[model samples]
Target: MLIRNKALFNKGLMLMGSFLCVFVSLFLPIWGGHGNGLDAADNMFNRLSKGSSYFIPGVKEDALKLEGKSVTITVKVKDAELAPRAVENLVKAGATAEFKDGAITYSGDLGKVLGAALIDADDLFNNRGPAVLERYAATEKNAEKTIVKAWWAVLDPSIKELQKQKLIQEAKVVGQVNKRGLEPGYNFYGINSEKVLDNVLPLVGLLAFYVLYTMWYGYAIFDMFAGIGLGMSKPKTKSEA
Candidate 1:
């Protein structure tokens, strides 16, 4: 290529080399030598995400509004073996649960039953797997038969049954409890929890690096293009006739 602007070409090369240096450093444990920059950022976000996913408290308020409301619903479990465990969960939650005709029929206060579910979800969310396991009298040997999954099996059918009975508000509240409360607990289980305030410095540093890195790339491209005489130029103004 012809040497259009040696100064701009050198500047571009310098910026690219510096960018590569930072890129390579990202793979090293530059963040306190405990983990690479990328890992640190990933862990920080995971923790922050878990911290923000605490919706059980709000769901509890809505669910408890269903206090003294009795609901009789039969929920089917796809896995026959797990039906009994789901029964145990509801029964433990102050509900009468019986497994018959290939389904578990529950009868009890709606609020109390949902309250028990929220407690289990809270335990799982806090990484207290033993608490949930103990609640269901289960072991993790099968992994699939965990208490959380059993909650899902029961909650799914319960929601449908509620909707069928035209208890729309009850159905919505139960669905919200399952989705916002239990789902987050299950999804974010085992992730570290952190407040944004506690991680302000690192969060700020990561965000700043992102902005600078993006701009660094843009500047590199702009300089390289300008050096090669490929830069955009302003169009000549048209003379008024």
Candidate 2:
């Protein structure tokens, strides 16, 4: 190929080579405590995400309104071993629970039952899995799955029964606790918490790098094209009458 602009060509080569170097560095284990650049960025975002998803406090407010509301429901436990643990959790929450035939018939004030769930969800959200296990008399093996899963099994049906009893607000509170509390807690269990303010610098840096890197590639291509005599030019207008 004929060399049209040697300086532009060399600049492109330099930019592209440097860009490639940075790209390869992303996979290297350089970020302390969080593996590579990719992993570190993902970890940072996960922590920030978990930090932002704390909705337990609002749900608790909703539950407080239903403090004296009463509910009675029998939820069948698919896992027989978890049945007793589920009953224990209910009883500990100031509910009367009878475990028979792999189903737990529980009765209590609506607020206390939901409050207990919120406590468990908060613990799990804060990465306190052992606290939940201990609360439910559960062992470490499959601890989170066994305990959290049991809570879900019981609460899910209780919400349905509450709806059947026309306790709409009460049911909504439990649903919110499950969605905003338990799910996030379970999903983001092991991630370290990071506030957005604490990570403002790095977060902004990553976003800025993303924008610059995209432009970096575009300019590299443009420079290379210009060096090869492929630059666009404004068309000359015909001399008028």
Candidate 3:
């Protein structure tokens, strides 16, 4: 009885261990969150259809590729009072800021600009330090927002137009050229289908592991039941009888 009980306990432990391993494997990747794949894809598509506003001359085309592009955009603004406001606008516009060496460097997307605006407004009332610094900071913050907004607004409209043009071209090519047996030309840009698939691989892998874990647990349960059945099936030898 002691030995059988020990064996049962061991089996239970083995089952628990297997279950834990499977659970950890399935959830570990999910805990890391869905990476910036979707964002990167959007940016890539935007860049492909409409040129990037931030793209500088001499920057390698390959560098612009979404495979390893950084989502952060950094801008420097001078003024201590402006720094806080600038940071605020940056945050509103979906950005972050750091004050360094008399300059506030803001990094983010369109949302960051809104955040900077908010910061600038707040500083107007709260800033009480060096008047010179405060005045300059306020001016700098406003200037930065105006410049950024103008550039982005201009680029935004152009991008929309470019997308429209691309769509029309694609439709014409597909409907007329392809039908006529000429090679169909489609503009390839941004994140391709393969990349999207790759992005989902982590999620898929997690689900696959979950399925595997279920199978393993089911087998373990069956094995335990089989052991119990075998123990019951053994004929009892009654020596005293």
Predicted structure with the largest lDDT when compared to the true one: 1
Query: What clash pairs does model 1 have?
Result: none
Quick one: how many clashes does candidate 3 have? 18
lDDT of 1 by residue, 1-241 (tens): 8869989988988998899998999899877638998887888899998888898999999988999999999878888877877888888888999999998988999999889888888888888877777766676573423667678778877888999999999999989988988888787788878899998997898899899999998898889889988888998999999
Model 1, residue 14: C-alpha shift (Å): 2.6
Better of 1 and 2 by TM-score: 1
Q: Write the per-residue lDDT of candidate 3 for residues 48-159, one digit (tens) a residue.
A: 3332222222122221231221133333443345455545544544556565675444444432232233233222222212332343343653443333333232222322
Candidate 2 lDDT over 18-81, as tens digits, reads 8899999999998787599899888889999988998988888887787888888887776778
The 0-to-1 C-alpha lDDT of every candidate, in the order given, reads 0.85, 0.82, 0.39
TM-scores for all candidates?
A: 0.80, 0.78, 0.23
Off by over 4 Å in 1: 28-35, 75-85, 94-105, 141-145, 237-241
TM-score of 3: 0.23
TM-score of 2: 0.78
For lDDT, candidate 2 versus 3, the one ahead is: 2
Cα distance off (Å), candidate 1, residue 142:
8.2
Ten contiguous residues with the weakest lDDT in model 3: 177-186
